[model samples]
Target: MTIDPEASPPRPPGRPRSREADEAILGAALDLLIERGMGATSIEQIARRAGVTRATVYRRFPNLTDLLVRAIEWEYQNTQPEALSWPDVPAMIRDWAGQLSVPRSRRLIRRLYGTVDDLPELLRAYDTAHGSHRGRAVRSTLEQARTTGQLPPHTDPETLQLILSGAALQHLAAYPDTTEPKDIEAYFLAVLRQVGFPAASPSPSRRSTQR
Candidate 1:
């Protein structure tokens, strides 16, 4: 499995954590978070759902908060594209559209957003695991685009990044049930153009490949 650079370091020296048990625990936590939300999720429930002893969970994570944080991080690590750098803007857009189109993914994201005040750690974990990294990758791609004239000379990648990210969040709120990949792709591409990214539309063949 690919390691997450932002993932917490290995546990202190002692007994090794079972990979199977870890997966089970994380998976259970995620399910409970989506099904029950943060307020109702507990370590005992996670342990029960994971089919592991409370002691087994305590041995791995100290509390419910830590376990849930790790669960969100694990989910992102599994779902996101592994490449830290994208070759181009359209590739990034394609990958993000596919990710956003999953119903479970949309639900999970909404659940995470609902945790902002009551359970800030989940969002923090997400930012650490993917948000910051994705921002850098997108900025780098925008820089390349500007140099290559795909974007206007005066286009500020940093400002544009913020705008693009905000637009995505706005879109998620505006159309919470949108699950069609092509529709999601079109929305993002339009947002990109509105923000001054002038990359041409994907050809029919490229669109088919993305599907």
Candidate 2:
């Protein structure tokens, strides 16, 4: 398991906060982080964009690093697998392809990955927070499939998860002609075909469940 930096330095307990303000601040922070990155994003900028007082932003987060960490997490959550339970392998592949095919998602992925070397803390913050949610879920689903004899005896869940996600991320980051959802969907299906995507057993647990 990876260290969870986001869980450390826990949030302080206080009076109930205004939900709208929280959303506004987070929204503004995410926009700034994506548009300019950690170096350029600041509390003042977020405050101005969110139309909230600096004090309000401070009340929520003590520092810019914390704020950026949370904003990165917000972006990460938006892209994670939506299925809380098991999802169909083919369908999830297509869904991920569709997501990565979009211009917004492409830019977000490029920005995040482009910053990985320069800003290790950005990744540390995100990885510690929610980077592995999709991997975990996919692993669980693969394990279930293997255990049920739906997948080949040689099927490796971890590697499969890496290959699936890695391909999607690479395609999103590297490909320019994949802006169409169908293009992405087609690409993922090709990957699946190469891997011989196992047919799901006629079982309830194998059915896709979208969140």
Give the candidate number with the greatest lDDT: 1
Which 10 consecutive positions of candidate 2 have the poorest summed lDDT? 202-211
**What lDDT tens digits, residue by residue, belong to model 2 across residues 57-89?**
887899987787777776666553555345556
Candidate 2 structure lDDT: 0.72
The TM-score obtained by model 1 is: 0.79
Candidate 2: residue pairs that collide: none
- Candidate 1 segments exceeding 4 Å error: 1-13, 77-82, 176-178, 199-211
Candidate 1, lDDT over the whole model: 0.83
Clashing pairs in 1: none
Candidate 2 stretches greater than 4 Å from native:
1-15, 74-82, 144-151, 198-211
lDDT of each: 0.83, 0.72
State the lDDT of candidate 1 residue by residue for 34-109, as single tens digits: 8889889889899899988777788788999999999888877754455767777888888778878877777787
